[model samples]
Target chain A: MKPENQTISPNQLFYLVSVFLLGSSVIFLPGAQAGSSAWLAVGLGALEGLIFLAIYNALVRQHPGKNLIEMNELVFGSFLGKVVSWLYLLFFLFVSAMLLRTFASFFAIIMTSTPLMVFLITPLVVSSFAVRSGLEVLARYSQIVLMTLVLLFCLESILLAQDMDPSNLLPFMDIPISEMLLAIQNVAAIPFGEAIVFLIFINLVSAPLEAGRFMRRSFLFSGILLVLYAVRTIAVLGTHSTISTYPAFAAVRIINIGEVFTRLEILLAVVFLSLGFVKGSVFYYGAVLGFSQLLKMRSHTPLILPIGALLLNISTLLFDEYIYDIIDANMLFPLYSMVFAFFLPLLTLIVAKIQKRRIQKGE
Target chain B: MLNVFLVIIAYILVGLFEAPGLIRNKYWRELSIVAVLLSSSLTLSLLLAMGVRLPMIIPVIYRAFVPLLTWLGIM
Candidate 1:
């Protein structure tokens, strides 16, 4: 069992949430489904993300100091709470698998020499090691690595300036309303919906109210970066945004700084690997903790390696080909994720409200 | 095959890494979870080593969900 003494301050929580939000989404760029309207979709996605964070923040405020699991237990009582908690764990497990697969599959497209397992297994093992060290280690690791990531992104964007033409973002907001709405649905589930895992970490905030503050800031910071990235990618890739498998990589690959420095895309490997590491480690830790909590175990470390291995296997075998999962994600995942993102939290909030009223009536 | 051998060695190393604490602490549930994990990993690894085509999760999930998904207007 991790001691309660392992509390991280709101400041650290802010960096952690920012890095977590920036994690896998940057590499994948889910808003490209909106075409030239991708930049607009990303902006709207940020607005939606703020709403999502507001719900999470409100939930945290209503039941200060209690994490998502404890909140479930309080709202639903022990037996049902554990069931809901188990479902959260299952969601964590599958989502971790989904992300691992996404990253690995992206690399598989780039390099064919390595067998698929080689890519899938490395991050899972590395993340298990990180999870075993506890949250303080993750927080410190993110603080340092996130600085490097930001610096690298700034450098890459500067180098790519010649290739990016703003005119490529023309015909903006021209997509059909239904298509834009669909893109929004898809965008919401990604990056932000994946953040449903944050519920596990928010309870560890020293002052529970500060958790909300840190998270809202993280949302905005990550939101701005994502929106800029989508616009930049669309500006460079133009009509290719709809077809480019890894648009960010494609956009970055063409950077030529006075003909002396080309293929700067190599540095992007850092972005992909590091951000994926942070994202994977977060979800992996969440799954391990949630699983142990579901089992009523006080310590999660003992289960880390096994769960990590299971995650590797599941993620490696997640799809026959990458595109099927991509399509499913765009199609069904929005609906699937809403069960967690909207319904579950909303249910908990409503039920908690009713219980509080009953208690006040008694008092 | 060399790959199968390496896979076995990896499982053994994982066992070596985990066994002592589990025994010292009498962590039966963890020991079981490790056992299941190692066995599954080895099974998949050995199959890959032998060049057997592995069945994927999507077909089953797609088959089962097509009706429900279609019904929900999400297919």
Candidate 2:
């Protein structure tokens, strides 16, 4: 089946976006550099993220029925467009590889005995299958995953309520405004602004025009979840949340309600992994679909496993230690991500608008 | 050795599963692309299994950004 023929509902789009947004960031806690003010950073970051989302949505609206790859071709002409598209394809693949690495590292920490490749291959294989099945299947799967994660997260949060120290969140925003701004930038760059990938899927929605609305709703939902997640980490782990690599998991690890709910970090792991799967699948599918479309291939199925293997290899090479991933997230990723997430999309939208005016004048 | 063998077998299985469908459809271009990607990935995976260290661009990129971030006082 041609991927273009597959369509998912707006609700499915919402679920997929929410799941993808929460993916690794939920466990990794994107704005931990802000210390006790991590939640505030995320809150401000969501506002900035909305601006990025609006740019992506405007670009999609400008080029309805066309993915970011196709829009590049139409806006920039064949040669330059192909170059831009290739860069974007690489960006998508790189993001997928990063997500895959994050997933593997998370599991590697908890399941210390399991080989890292096993964790990496598991999600890669599953995502390859989902990508080959087409976008509808992936979206439907995300719908189920997002619902389960929400229910479990709520249950876990209520169970950990007694463990939350309100004072941990006190003296908030005490950090230098510059550090706070950097943390906000970090949150905006990751999890939120990374929704630029959704531009690829916007064309896949049955209601393409309404895709932006659904995306906004998903952002609101995930933004709230992200703030709650940051607050939870700060409340539960307090100062340790700033230093803990996996703050969400560490917070949940302290859940010892009469020792009955001890080791609930396992539960958080399950939720994070599920979100990771959806996140990985979206990026994987976007990269493959974009590649096939860029090549003018009739189908993306044949490309799935081959690209998956490359992705697995790339993921392995991404970070030797988990600490590098954290450093990259804190220091480099925000700036590095901006080129693709903000600059390129903004450039595309402006050129598309200019071209549209020229065409209208010619008519 | 076993890890390398398993990596090879995994690549072979993936090839067998995907190549036949492309050949059946006579999707020559698609088949070629798949062959190129699969072979390259196989080589990379084999090297990885053999404990070879491949050069990574991420660190370089991270390094390149360090001065900019530090100058801005974000680092």
Candidate 3:
């Protein structure tokens, strides 16, 4: 709550952005994009993300030391501004739910047969506690988790090198151009575009000018890491990557250094849990912060539990009976997110600029 | 069947008790209720229209209130 007490260096901010974006997506993106051409999607997606980040940077520059909610009120009229701010809060909450559900479903499939809700509730409770501690703790926690994830990822990728077939990358770009573009849009909207949530905490950075540099570094680092993982998944699973529901998990399952290095998906699960925890905590924090701003509350700590409970309920309720609904979320939620996260914010920025210009001319 | 409903009830009760402390101002109390109700209704309608079955007990309550609320011209 004390901005002076919260001092996150530019390096830490970079690490937070990298880890938050890289998270669990690297494990599954190859399977989602599939085949030899997934890297093409990654390349295009990174470019789209950079453009989106530019728009965000412009917004940040225009409203130094203000989060999106405050800027919304400054830009739009009170009623419309509150609506937009609330929509963003809802978006953050929905994302938190989706990530929680995904992590839970993954555990249910690979790690345990216990009820998904039981596995999920533990993370939700933990994340609520983490968010209540405030942003500095979350940022520091992300740094530690990101380091562990990177170490484990490098070790796993190396161990799996034997199973990898370079031939799997052959015949690249075979997919239609349109499909590749669609994949780019998907990637942009997801892992890259969703990092727009960082805008909520941009004011917390020790150096605002370095935000662009830190964000770019985070995107490139995460982008490269994801591309490497995708390459590994393709090489290990070959054309079978498309068939496997969780190609990264399957790839990890296939790793065997003369049978001693088998079944390291457990290690991958640790990475997933760490990344998922950071992601959930960040969104949960954002939701609480946005709610506080909307109500003009001094702090969000007391509200954390109720919001966490609401999210827990919404997580369970949001999904349909079939897993296909979850997949449909992959298809639908990204577009919905773009409206609030990118398009709406951009509109607000334009309106703010116009209003400022009008006031200056009147003077 | 009964257990899940009970768990949900417990969750809602926890939320209701905490809500007052979250935003203590009178204006915020009214705003918070409106925000919760409108958002919940919007989500419920959207999910139902998508053909997702609401868990049985929740649907019964929603069905009862939704019509009554709609008839009163309140979302």
What does candidate 2's lDDT look like per residue over A164-249, in tens digits? 99999988688998899899999999889788888777777888889999999988999998999889889998899988888888
Q: Model 2 clash pairs?
A: none
The residue pairs in collision within model 3 are: none
Give the alpha carbon lDDT tens digit for every residue of B1-75 in model 3.
Answer: 565455556556655655665456544654464457445644553554355666732233345556644563323
Best by DockQ: 2
lDDT of 2 by residue, B11-36 (tens): 98999998888898889999999999
Model 2 interface DockQ:
0.75
lDDT of 3 at A339: 86
Number of clashing residue pairs in every model? 0, 0, 0
Rank candidates, TM-score, best first. Answer: 2, 1, 3
lDDT per residue as tens, model 1, A215-309 = 88888888888888888788888898778777888888888877888887767777778877888888898888777766765467767877776
Task: Please report how far candidate 2 places residue A74 from its true position, in Å.
Answer: 1.0
Off by over 4 Å in 3: A1-7, B1-75
Predictions' DockQ, in order: 0.48, 0.75, 0.09
TM-score, per-candidate, Cα-based: 0.92, 0.96, 0.84
User: What TM-score, to 2 decimals, does candidate 3 have?
Assistant: 0.84
Q: For candidate 2, what is the total of clashing residue pairs?
A: 0
Off by over 4 Å in 1: A1-5, B1-5, B29-55, B63-75
